[model samples]
Target: MNARLPERQASRALLIGSSRFSHEGLHDLPATVNNVQALADALTDPAMGGLDPSGCRVLTDPATPKQVGDAIDAVVNEALDTLVLYYAGHGVLSRHGELFLAVEITDPDPYRVHYSGVPMTWLRSALAESPADNRILILDCCFSGHAVEAMSGTASAVGGKLDIRGTYTLASAPAHETAVAPVGARFTAFTGELVKTLREGIPGCGPLLTLGDIYPALTRALVASALPRPQRLNTDLGDHVAMTRNPAYRPPSRSASKPRVVSQPHRSPTGPHRRASDEQDPKVAAEFHSAMLDVYRKAKKEAGYNAAYFLQMVQEVGGLEAARRLIRAGSVSSGFTALWEKGRLDLSVEAVVLQDRFAGLFTDEELDIARDRLAEYGYSSAQTS
Candidate 1:
């Protein structure tokens, strides 16, 4: 039966979301927590699909780090078939690649922080200790990096093979950007789409939707629609991950009715996306530039990266085609940056050209249009940025 296959053991989901918190109160944490509760309910409903709630334990929202840590500690030892941790609140990341998913966090403070958010290192250790051989983490907060960032580089196959455990982290954005919450959406854009893709039974959903796939989907969609795009950070040492293209996966149908959770809202997770296509429409491409410029502005206002850096990008880089592909890759894809870091070190005209304002920062390749345009300025290489 589809209800029970491959694995019939217990499973657990730890979820958290925070929003609209007062200087001392939480804002929108309830919405994401509520959605997770619904997801938990659906997972428990034998009539709809799979296992019973008895097979799983859930930790929704804990006001303190110790509370969260303690709750997760209990779940880790439960020996479930699949262990999932979903956090849907505001997240903050440090320059050192650390991440935090807030619970009762009222204000942003790194040390002596309010409302403890479980650290990625700690969470990963918990996963390492979890009795489950398969562990999946669906992080809906911004800058939810750490565990995933640890797993980013190409690795060699040592010993007989590299098979330890299955760990998947779906972070909303890079550790450096703000996560977007759509105007009327119950939760943030990343959480909404994730629920849709996972529930839609879309072919590209689930374990197939790797960090690479999800990172781009959120960022690109955010950039296209004028919402803030989250940076995608990931980690997987041995096994391959399928990003939104897994054949065995299926999304859940649109809820015929809204389901209530313990003490929160009854909003649906899946909804419509609002980005224009760069590949298909030239007009969209032009608009995207303006939209990205806005993104550049917000990045400066919110994060404080040098304005000239982004301004140089918008003014110097000419075409957006590469950006489309770049954001789609999900990772930082800092293509224009690659020239300085990897290809050109001397800051040659090529290096400077790579950093051109109009040049695509999202990708490395130069589209035909970009190439011809650059040629008009004396550079002939149409190669990706």
Candidate 2:
């Protein structure tokens, strides 16, 4: 075992979320993709007290395991202490009791396997190669047991013991159960609810927000949202599930400079924004915003993504009334929960304008989703807030 560990817990994270990938309808539902992305963002967030935000890397399938492995490779080599891995999407188990990632691959032979998912065993080995003191893994897929069972059951990554102290693992649901999520509302589904817990509701839970407290809260939320009742279970692979070993985590001192923390992401020019202010030109920012926009626009058609964007952008250009005509035009799309409260769920010219206004002044936290909505409307993500 590679017993030598980091002086403190420096971490590197890898996030993977598979979507409507398998031909056999693996990611057949919208929630499947949305949940994966949400979970990825949650896990990679440095604010979660998991890792250095800058060190997180995300990989998607169709993208090879080699490519995925390669990204994690860089972080591991950097000597980060904790390695946090999160996966969201579909998983498949074979009669032979093997677990696979079930990418956008299909088995043409029906009776014979044509494509094989990424084996979790392969991933555990990769983590073993890292010099980090601990590893925290989270998987949000169906049939996730064998892979984790394989990783945790085998001894020898942390210290001399295979089941090392301080190594933590959390799985969305237990093995063999078909986890359920909304057919299309991925973002607000079970996974989304969990993020909400961490983001908006944790403090409300009172006192210390331990993983023991947090994990089950999220699990209960997930099972509660399951339609027609879901087959669900949460697992604690090893004994040491140290909720979060936050090096700098502490209650803010009641001092003159102590600022009340708000749940919103918009907290002014904090990290990246401030950093970008120094070197990035407007054009570079535009490019970054635009690229992500394209992907969002493509997806907006199904959700109310585009309408909101169109309304907002129109206000940014012409005026509020001009945006209304578009909302009143024709048949509305589905999926998104009606969020605005301009009297009705329908995007009134006024709410559209307000939406646009909010987008203009979006808190950094709200910015990404706002950008995605803009993308639905074919707007650039880099629109200066």
Candidate 3:
């Protein structure tokens, strides 16, 4: 069945990660930090999940169960169309075999976990009570599949069977299997694939990615990687709820129209004016560059601002140096005018140069030049859409 993307303004997401644990028995999952940040970036990306930046909240190393509970409660109260809850880190079992999410202060002792960690029941209850039509829960932790049982009313630890009518639960591992977090990996095995799937998208999927579309992809990826298989539970057509735009979707090609020919002045080949075709026909070159820029802009708009490979290059070499390299490589040229003319100020080099994270990379004069160029194009920070 065809699935529809959620309304960005009416959706809310809560991402919780516990990276640092106080008890020595539980090793610190440094990868959890990257997991939360990358997931947040993917979800809020205009070309992907398209959630409002304000609507997605990240709570890392939460100090207490109350803190996590309160954050979940807040988003549950505000979300109207879709509510997404994601948690990564350690999952401990209570003495009664119930699942409890580890926090910074959570002890490894199963008896003490009930008081120190956030119980899965809290999330189950939240999902049961949420007013949103579509509720999604993603757990990346050890024995996360226990959540599936809890949601299905088979787990005795949850006290009584709970109704999960409009929810979809995706877990990283089976009840007995431990989720993998390779040493020095940027993210846990499960979440790394999840983020990659969200960013790169499934090639054969429809324009919008739904829970059902994502699950098989995730399973195939995990199986290919030799990782533990993930599990899920869906009810009331929860699997059809669209989560993000598919980055890999391609429209069918149509016949191309004839190119518009512009008249050019005759040039002397023997004089100093002799040069390349672009130099001879500046208008034609500008048009070519404009077309190339359009392709780049379309890619950025569909894949996401952070999903570009150039952004990674910028991150590795610094933004200004990356720009210099691109210029030297002749992969890019002065195309601000082209971008401005096309109402794609978001794709302007100035937008990247002036980003707060790239501060101190460009000189004040260079920044001023970028700002002036954008201003000339009637670009404003508030005009992003």
Candidate 4:
């Protein structure tokens, strides 16, 4: 059976990576930081996972179990279609042979782990309780394979015997083996391959990538690199859920023998004006332009400007009307802050509406209002211009 990508708005992902450790026995994994960031980028890429940036959350160096649990619970509550929980850090075994995910203050003592670490059983229970149709748990730490055992009802860990349905658990290594994190590497061994697969994609896979398609490729790559083989446990076709669009997929070309027909340009009317390529509604044009700007900024690794919500105001009212609303609102919007954070001062509303291509979209008074808004935020028109 064919599988498709999850509904972007209905799916949520929480990525947790503990990169530092205060314990003497546990070594710090600096690569885990890069692992979370790179994975977040891959998942939020429109050409790949197509998830909204707001839907994916990254937590680094969590201080306690409650912090991680709270974040997971939030995502579980928000996600209706798919929930992805990813963790990268140290995995230590307790006295009862149970797995415990190491946090910033985690100690090596088995008895102390109850207070310092997050038990694998906690994750299992969370997944079992989640209302999402598909639950994906990715663990990149030593003894992570124990999670598979716990979910399968074979592990003797406390609270590990829960029946988790519609879940897929992917572990970096065997229950006894240590996951690799080569020194000076950008990402952990297992996650590096995962990110590569999400970015470059499998050559022959169809248009969408599923867990079933990714597992064998991961196995082959890890074996070639002489790394510990990954393990997985899937229940109720969970493996068939599509994770992302295949980057390497190419649609078949049209037949060369088909005859070509040329047609006159179609003109759309806007009030008393008619244009061949312009949108009939100025508000719609503004929204489209704003969304396209976000796509461009994202490709360049800049922070998103929250174009969807911001542009909705323009779509509901015309550009000039939206400008009046913004002036009356008397506060800078999040989109402007996002632009400021990315050092994209040039994309501000004052600069955008002032561009030659958008000259007539807003009146001089509206342009002055935009400039005044920027000035209120301590930016000059000359700087934005």
Best by lDDT: 4
Q: How many residue pairs clash in each candidate at the backbone level?
A: 55, 11, 0, 0
Candidate 2 Cα deviation (angstroms), residue 151: 3.1
Candidate no. 2 TM-score = 0.50
For model 2, the superposed segments whose C-alpha errors exceed 4 Å read: 1-9, 25-33, 40-50, 106-115, 154-165, 188-190, 201-209, 225-385
Worst 10 residues of 1 by lDDT: 268-277
What's the TM for model 3? 0.65
lDDT of 4 by residue, 282-335 (tens): 665666466445443562455544455545666677554554454433234434
N/CA/C clash count, model 2: 11
Worst 10 residues of 4 by lDDT: 267-276
lDDT agreement with native, every candidate: 0.47, 0.45, 0.74, 0.75
Ordered list by TM-score, greatest first: 3, 4, 1, 2
Pairwise lDDT winner, candidates 2 and 3: 3
- Write the residue-wise lDDT of candidate 3 on 237-325 in tens digits: 67778777889876433421122222343643222222232333545434434433544556466533322444455557644455434
Model 4, residue 248: C-alpha shift (Å): 1.4
**What is the TM-score of each predicted model, taking all chains together?**
0.50, 0.50, 0.65, 0.65
List runs of model 4 lying over 4 Å from the truth: 158-161, 252-385
Q: How many Å off is the CA of 282 in candidate 4?
A: 65
- Estimate the Cα RMSD of every predicted model relative to the unseen true structure: 17.0, 20.7, 18.1, 19.7
